[model samples]
Target: MTISKHIYFAAPMFANSDLRYNAYLVKKIRQLNHQVTVYLPQENGDINEKSAYADSKMIAQADADEVLKSDLLIAILDGLVIDPGVASEIGIAFAKEIPVIGLYSDTRQQGADNQKKLAALQETAENQFHYLNLFTAGLVKLNGQITNNEEDFLHGIQKFLETGEINDLS
Candidate 1:
């Protein structure tokens, strides 16, 4: 029997491609019968408002509410640098002790367009010995897993469902 889990899907939704990619992931997970109830912020948040501050606050609250209710967070950490909002969401999940699974599907070797930015990120990764931020990586290490491809994400999800635990940080 498969256990049903609620996953807070955190990803970059700044581009049309990103939204489509998120939909693909959601569909694939459902097709695989992982029994996950995904909470996607991009789909749930209220973006259009007269006041910029109000809009931002509303969106933040919506996302935070979902994060608070989720059993775990499935974060797409694909960009050269982690998205600031996603980073903040990760922090919330971490503080709440919710599990986090980081999915780094981008295979490109170039860390950033700028040489200096790339060097800085490389140094940060090397210094902390993590592919991303030390704090974020530590949170994932403590609770869930990290995967780098679609196959791995699927397998990781299955594994997590079965064991209620994950260790795929490889």
Candidate 2:
């Protein structure tokens, strides 16, 4: 029998929106008989300092080690930009030659086609995006980019796993 692939999910955990889609993605991956682990840097950032989840050293080491070990990665690329920690894991997974899927959603509005004050911000954001793409091309290049949003957001995960298609949420 074929072994199920282990998918390491990376995304922002600061907002409820992050958890909404992330939880769904994890659930669906599990349904496919694959192991899913979320590498939240914030959750275990103090591993070396010690608290919950094993000792600090162990926690930090395990977090770093798991990304190196996973078969594939599914990342949420929503918000104004991507999370730095998530980007790091994406790079590591890419070096390991694992499949890295990008799931992005822009929750912001168009700003009535761009006000004068917003123009500078728009240009800067565009420039950053270009550099990000150039820097992390391998893993972040993605099989594709997803652009769908749901009331609950489970549909995004469902679509990502089931279709293997990246819907551009631009």
Candidate 3:
């Protein structure tokens, strides 16, 4: 029998788009491994219901509790910048020695070999790429990895479940 594992999914859950995307990805991850239980914060209506009145301490303590219990954390790294809440979860997971898998699906990260895109980097503020905070990303890399797409992210989870190790997917 497969051993059951718990996962903490950290992402921005304020907007409708973010909510839909988080649910979709969590569903896909569940389909990939039935033995895994993903703790998606948006599902916790007690503290996550925007219509309700949950104070800052309530939200932080609730989410941090789940993060501490997770075997792994899958953080969504797609935004104008890494969501502050997600960054905090990454830090918590790192401090507790839980591995993290960051999904960075920004399209701006493409065109690695395009000469024009590379040349644009010479101009100030003309960089053709999205930047992720290195410190938060470093915390993830110290224990796990950051995947560019969903396919690789799922693969990383599978590998970690089977062997408790993250391979360099670059």
Winning candidate number (lDDT): 3
When 1 and 2 are scored with TM-score, the better candidate is 1
Distance from true location, Cα of 122 in model 1, Å = 12
Candidate 3: which pairs clash?
Answer: none
TM-score computed on alpha carbons, candidate 1: 0.76
TM-score for each model = 0.76, 0.56, 0.95
Worst 10 residues of 2 by lDDT: 125-134
lDDT of 1 by residue, 47-124 (tens): 523233446677787889989998878888877678788888888988898888888776554454656655565663
Return the TM-score for candidate 2, rounded to 2 decimals.
Answer: 0.56
Model 1: lowest-lDDT 10 consecutive positions: 45-54
> Which of candidates 1 and 2 is the stronger one according to lDDT?
1
Report how far off residue 151 is in candidate 2 (Å): 13
Model 2 lDDT per residue over 1-170, tens place: 33434556777776667667566666665665443344444445555223445664665467668777766566766655567767777777777766666654453433435556355566745422212344554456653333334422344344445544334422
- The local lDDT score (0 to 100) that residue 104 gets in candidate 2 is 48
Q: Give the winner by lDDT: 2 or 3.
A: 3
